[model samples]
Target: MMADLREMYTFEFMRYALTVGVFGGGMLAFLGIFVHLRRIVFLGAALPQITALGIALAIALHLPLLVGAVLGGLVGILLLSTSGKPGHLPTEGWVGLAYASGGSLAIVVLALSPHPDAGALRFFTGDVLGTNRAEALFAIAVAGFTALIFRLCWSKFVVSSFDPVMSQTLGLKVRRWNALLFLCLGFGLAAVMNSAGSMLAFGMLIGPPAAALMCFRAFPKVVVTTVVLGAGAAFVGLTASFLFDLPGGPTMATAALAPVLPAWIYRKIRK
Candidate 1:
């Protein structure tokens, strides 16, 4: 088994997939902490579907799929930002609408393609092993940019998320900061979905953070733990996919859930 694993990395595609799985998983897990904390987990589901629709449209238009996915996700975030305001639809309603609309549009667009089934399957399951250097570099760039923004504005983000009233009292530009955070979230979602597809993106975004929250009380510790566990799951899942000839995205997503189930069970028993 060890020999097989070592030999797998000898292939560039395997290496690229592993690189994406690790870094992309960590990035998703990091942003996921904020998503869970803010009680807006629906973004995880909605944004990825939007991204998928974007990829589908890109395929139909013969454009760059990543660009389409990013644009779609950003548009979804913008619409979601207006949700829950007075006279506006609630966040949940917006998320549901986005998910439904995106999925439907993707299906319709893909049906017009020459190989609709293949395109549809790739959108649903992803092709992590088929990842190239360009996609990996793009993922790295997105992750790095997101980390820099969070590092510089960590305190402000925390204040806005945890205590919006206090943020208003402090004269913080709360709406602007929130918009920035949403932008970061949308970009990160697009990058990850490009490699891991929508389902796996949603899974990594929620599972590791939720599990870490169950095990740790401190915010910093939770962040660290979530990154470690998420990356580890990606590694394991990628390896398993190679060994078992399984789909990388779903396998990785399931691996992410592995820790979550045990953590949830333990927390429930203790409570």
Candidate 2:
């Protein structure tokens, strides 16, 4: 059974896949807790596809795709800034328009760009089995950043998460903190993009924390369970991708959903 998925690492891309599965899983597992709790999972959710547009544009224009993605994320942040929610800069209506525009812009760019190929397909589809040493190092850096932030600002983030007004009243720069959190999520989204591609990246952003929150009894448990589920999903998904010769990123994402779906269905049934 295991031989069906014997990884052939003679090719470089396969290493990148597994590398991403491990390191990307680590970073995202940590980040998922915040996005899940804050209900802003969509930053991870929507931005990667938008980033793909930027990458496609860069391809056509002969620029670096990664730089294009960072630019795209910056554009997303700019759009969000104008989104009003109380102290938020943009109104709900404005945010909706922003999302619509972002998605539409990506489609237009893809349609206009030249030289679309499997290479480009990797962006939307994911290439988990293709992990390389450099990408793995990148993943480690992202994971390190996430861990550092979580350790240094866990309490502040938690207070703001559950009760923002009180957190602010205590002299925390509430608005600035929220913006910083979103920025972290954006950086995270960009970092994890290659590991899981678009939707898989979105799944990593949402799945583990969601599963942990549902299964665990306490906040601390949420953290532990989230990381565990994230790693488990990545391992299982990568294995599945190997067996089926499927795209690693989406397979990992679909596998990530495996735990969540049954739990969600069970919750609904019990209700």
Candidate 3:
């Protein structure tokens, strides 16, 4: 098994894919804690579709995929963040619209692109094994930056997130913190969606943190466990996919979600 593993990673592409899987999965899982805490899981789902739309637009316009993804994610954040205000449609309604339209539009735009790349389908279907060195490095950089920011502003972020009114009373700049958090979410989603596709991006964002939160109440332990599970799922899923000749992205997503049921059962038993 060890020799086979070594042989599999002897190719640079496999190493690059693994790097993206680990770092991208870990980062999305970490950010997912905030998504869960804020009860914005729908928003998380919508953003990936929006990011895909951006990728399709970039392909159509011959722009950078990262640039399009970032813009698309940010636009989704801006639109969805303000949707909680009193309106005819509930926030969920608007989020659902974005989710539906964004995905449909991406496919339409991609279909219309005059210069579509042969691998363009991979953007939606996922092609993690095709990841390049630059994409792997970008994943690492984004993950490191996210960790560093949260490390420096842990208390502020936590306080602002869970208790906005109290955060305002304490003059913690709640709005600024919230915006920063959304910015990080948008950036991270864009990066992950660009490389791993929307399925892996959304799966990693929701799965590990959901399981970790089910098992533990301590934020620090939850964070650690979530990252570990996410990265471990990526490794396990990629290896399984390789060995079984299955699809890599969906395999990783399934692995990421595998812990949820066990954790839920554990919680029920403890209670």
Number of backbone collisions per candidate, in order? 0, 14, 0
* Tens digits of per-residue lDDT for model 1, 1-271: 8898899999998988888888888889888999999998877788888888888877777777788778888988987777777677876888899889887888787888654434444657766776778778877888888888888989999998899999999999899889988888888788778777887788889999999999888988998899998899889999999899899889998898789889988889988
Which residue ranges in model 2 land beyond 4 Å of their true spot?
Answer: 1-11, 85-95, 114-118, 129-133, 265-271
Cα displacement (Å) at residue 134, model 3 = 1.4
lDDT of 2: 0.68
State the lDDT of candidate 3 residue by residue for 1-271, as single tens digits. Answer: 9999999989898888889899989999999999999999999999999999998998889997888888999999999888867857899999999999999999999999997888776768877887888788888888898899999999999999999998899889998989989998998888778877999999999999999999999988999999999999999989998999988888888999999999999999999
Query: How accurate locally is residue 14 in candidate 3, as Cα lDDT from 0 to 100?
Result: 82
- The candidate with the higher TM-score, 1 or 3, is 3
What is residue 52's positional error in candidate 1, in angstroms?
A: 0.9
Against the hidden reference, what TM-scores do the models get? 0.94, 0.84, 0.97
TM-score of 2: 0.84
Name the best candidate (by TM-score).
3
Q: At residue 110, give the lDDT of candidate 1.
A: 83
| lDDT tens digits by residue: candidate 2, 76-179 | 76666545668655455555665566667666776677755456556666765544565567777767777788789888878887898888788888777677
Worst 10 residues of 3 by lDDT: 118-127
